[model samples]
Target: MTKEQPIGFIDSGVGGLTVVKEAMKQLPNEHILYLGDTARCPYGPRPAEQVIEYTFEMANFLMEQHIKMLVIACNTATAVALEAIRAALPIPVVGVILPGARAAVKATKTQQVGIIGTIGTVKSQSYYQALKAKQQEITVTSLACPKFVPIVESNQFQTAVAKKIVAQTLQPLVHKQLDTLILGCTHYPLLRPLIQNMMGDGVTLIDSGAETVSEVSVLLDYFQLANPNPLKKRAIFYTTGSTALFDEIATQWLPITRAQSKKIHLGGTTNEI
Candidate 1:
């Protein structure tokens, strides 16, 4: 493994751009190769087995790029595939869930933590397991916001419709009066403003993307994989769906100049690379 090799990140779609944005800020010198399986996105609604397979394909592709480390940027994929990827890959594999759980545990003063993620993620109960593993006494309430991802992908983040959807999805948790809400899905952060407006000022909205980046910093330092260069590094993005759509959404949500997204078919062994 070369010291200057780029770190790899994978997501279901443009959602992972949130994680990449955080990485760019936290590790300015580290190069990154991001792959978004947008063609088969909304992994939230997919079966667990399929999500696992898709995540493996993406992880294997990134591994082929000789990435120094792998970051599973999708909460759904992280829930179903992180451990499997970690066991199979030689490099360090980091996911958004544990870091988010840790942050939520520390951020919540009331011991009531609310998590909103995709169906796959919420169903997996990864956050609940992780949070409990850290502090068994903490109360966890999880909700699946399937519509939230598409809303953000369409770039309807702060619109009235977006707020309405957020309010509807979050209404169930309001009575719980959570002190901290973990935006478990990477895409959820894009809806943070609307979510915050509905959840009120007392609740701390934890961005998993940001939390994951901090964890990545610690891991890179511990493993001596942190890029030593002082100059800013560039990031490359690839998508398994339409490049134009990915580019549009990415440019809107991230600090990307032009998304170098390309369409790829993930059906055979050739797709593994």
Candidate 2:
């Protein structure tokens, strides 16, 4: 709507910060407003109706903040609710799936692509659908990594235990000899090193979060909403979970000075949060 307005980002948990981190690096002049539904996180196992409801609530909340654009940073939410929100909202809305799919398609030499996401996302076959919709001949393999979200949410990423967990959960995909692997969940990018190492050097790890920000830039220009002022950039993070934990992980993961987080509730009839 206006240059003063910030771009909104929503995820199941702190995983969305991966996108916010990239936005910070790419669009330093623009501010960010992030919301994470940590209280009811790991949307991978939830029903599509529930995921849609939660995504609507978060998007509605972000809309109330006057954001010029919204990015659905959660893969599960993007799979289930992206179209509905985009069709209903006036502002431009971006999702991580398409960008990742495009990268996977371009990165793969053998047309073999692997995707790892939450159960809900995998079950929905959103990545397969998106990739196929782009190029029907592309081969897509998908696996559900339900434990990845909880591990990252608890700030256990990059540890020996985390590495082992990732390797075990992703073992099935390893044998597929996938030339490109889509880190379908936003949280999965934090474990990039372990995933890359386990999947080996030949497999290119596609971070959907990192890719989504490029689309953000495109939309900003298309909408003529790109912020030109570089002096007053800011980012505000809110979680339906613990602010302390979100603050801690965000600080560790992002390149910003510090993450300012507060606890907020969503999905009520009134403005309860």
Best by TM-score: 2
Worst 10 residues of 2 by lDDT: 264-273
lDDT of 2: 0.90
Model 1 over residues 94-123: C-alpha lDDT tens digits? 999999998988898889999999999999
What TM-score would each prediction reach against the true structure?
Answer: 0.96, 0.96
Pairs of colliding residues, candidate 2: 44-120
In order, what lDDT does every prediction score?
A: 0.89, 0.90
Off by over 4 Å in 2: 269-273
Clashing pairs in 1: none
Supply the TM-score for candidate 1: 0.96
What would the TM-score be for candidate 2 when compared with the true structure?
Answer: 0.96
